[model samples]
Target: MYDEMSQLKNLLELIEEPSDINLDPEEKKAAQVERLFNMLFEEHEEHAKIVADQLNKSVEEIRSLPYSEFRKVANDLGVADSLLFKIPRLNRPRTFMSPKDKISSKLFEGVLPPGTNKAEIAMENKKSTKELSAFVSVDFDMLPNIHSSQEITAYDREVHDAIVSLYVDGENEYITNQMVYRTMTGDPTAKLTDKNRTEIDNSIRKCSMTRISIESSPQEAAVYGMQTMKYEGNLLYTKVVTGVQSGHINEWIYIMEQPILYRYATSKGQLSRTDINLLNTPVNKNAETLMLQGYLLRRIEAMKHPKYNKSYNILYDTIFKHLKIEAATSGALRKKHSKLRDTIKKILDDWIEKGFIVGYKNNSDKGKSKSLSIIIK
Candidate 1:
């Protein structure tokens, strides 16, 4: 197993080249990248399974094994030794740190715009002071700070209190290093501030009407529709619709929607419709109202089951099937029509090229039809 793991890792490394060192370079690159990613994913899953299987053993017995012996066992089972090393790193960081600081820092970093002071922005966001302090302490620990951990703790508390006071007094819009220093010095106006009230007001106004488009990708549309179903509180039924526009070739979209029904029951728990139309909308569309309607029909068909009791569900299922079947038939007709149109266009172009079809005759309809007598062949 160890040998197999090493072989697989070596294979992955060999294929990591940007340019293919094998046949059909472009095709090779595409295949190799896909293969590599899939291989890594499968390897991780296999390693997890091995670790889970080990959980059945007694903890003391497991711990009694030396690192070398454990590595050999894992190797025999095809688990990569590097993966075992990574497990400690992955699990230890959180156990040694407080959740408040680490979790809040991560969340704050994600939400705040670039160039914002992390510690100050974190505090302004009402994050726990002790957590932020611990987080900052860890960060400062990596640096060559002369201050002792005890001194750092005291400084963090003082700064936290001062920042909270200014926040309450409306003197500071957010916490910052400078603000902390000013508060410590007992000077209110000593820090440089960029709490631009105008900017804040403008941001609020701008965000209120902000429209977020999902970029109309098929996967994104499907996920969005599923999310909408989850939002409507129905976890069971999630459906996705995908197809091309009948009349518009090379155009495709998906739609995701939810169907929900609730009724008052005599019992404390409400008697709800057995069939939840949790997903009842088109997940993707090309802005065509008619096409969107067709997409919705497909989703409805996917959700239909006899167990569903809601009258609306039954009606929706019936209508949706009718619409979907009609759209499919119409799509066939449109494809034939488009093919005929293309044929006519090609015939006209060929005639024109051969001098068999000329430009229209004189301005009046009385004039003879455009000449097409010349024979090029």
Candidate 2:
């Protein structure tokens, strides 16, 4: 039931690293469990008694159970199976990209400068400067296209999507420009040329500079095990290192998933994985499609039904929020809302044609009940 004491200590050390490593509440609990077991293995009867009480068994019975059986007993006591089996060593395939539910739902919805009116004014002024110089000096021609804080767009979210593959925890992660290129382009065979490499670098810089703040309800905070309901931080922090002698460059990107966001990632149920290749394709590249898809991806996963038989009921106002639609008057808002309904129909029709979904029904009644009922395939 116990491994070598030295091995157990090493595992605890790895989990409790003093760096900027962010462990969700469950991980901290897992660490506590390891500490308890280590004490029990050393014949600590009090710790054994605690587990025995929880499981309604004798201290000897609790100690006699194998580690696997102990996990099952703890699972029966409401410990998550993922924490017991998958967290210490995640075994996810490389094909799927796991973006946090909060990020997916809010990141593209006018949060990161795109879809906001301020972005339009900034684009017209065109005062973009070179911000990547802090990371690494490059040729004038090699600079990213939009370097200013206000120039973030839907395209930048693509970079965020790609980089999320590196965001397992709060610790800084290393990646090369080539890996970003492959992930963003969704083709492992895609070449890393000068133009696209500059684009990737620019996007990274843009993401690092953009700030985001999320305010969650008490219910939401409790659901994700967050101690607080409010969070404010930048989405990313990036440092680039160039090997002058080897002419190679690598990026150390720190994904700052705050307590709420980190809990969303660790909860497993609060995250959604999209096929990288299909998501980056030209068909889903537009802002509306991207925003709607992001919202749908997160919402669809929460549906309590099997696939091909499930449907989603989305409100017109909900679509307006996700798509960031704004209007000056009720009449104009209604017009734009009507137009957006058509736009959504066309987008859903395209999805149906591509066989991504089966069909949808419009339940708009020209009243407060305007909504869309979409059938999932």
Worst 10 residues of 2 by lDDT: 130-139
| Whole-model lDDT per candidate | 0.29, 0.50
TM-score of each model, in listed order: 0.15, 0.42
RMSD of 2: 19.7
Tell me the spans in candidate 1 whose CA falls farther than 4 Å from its real position.
14-109, 113-377
Task: Name the best candidate (by lDDT).
Answer: 2
Model 2 residue runs over 4 Å out of place are: 1-95, 98-104, 111-146, 149-152, 169-172, 193-195, 215-230, 245-268, 280-375
True-vs-predicted CA distance for residue 375, candidate 2, Å: 5.4
Which residue pairs overlap in candidate 2's backbone? none
lDDT by residue (tens digit), candidate 1, 53-97: 676644334334554554454455554433221111111010000
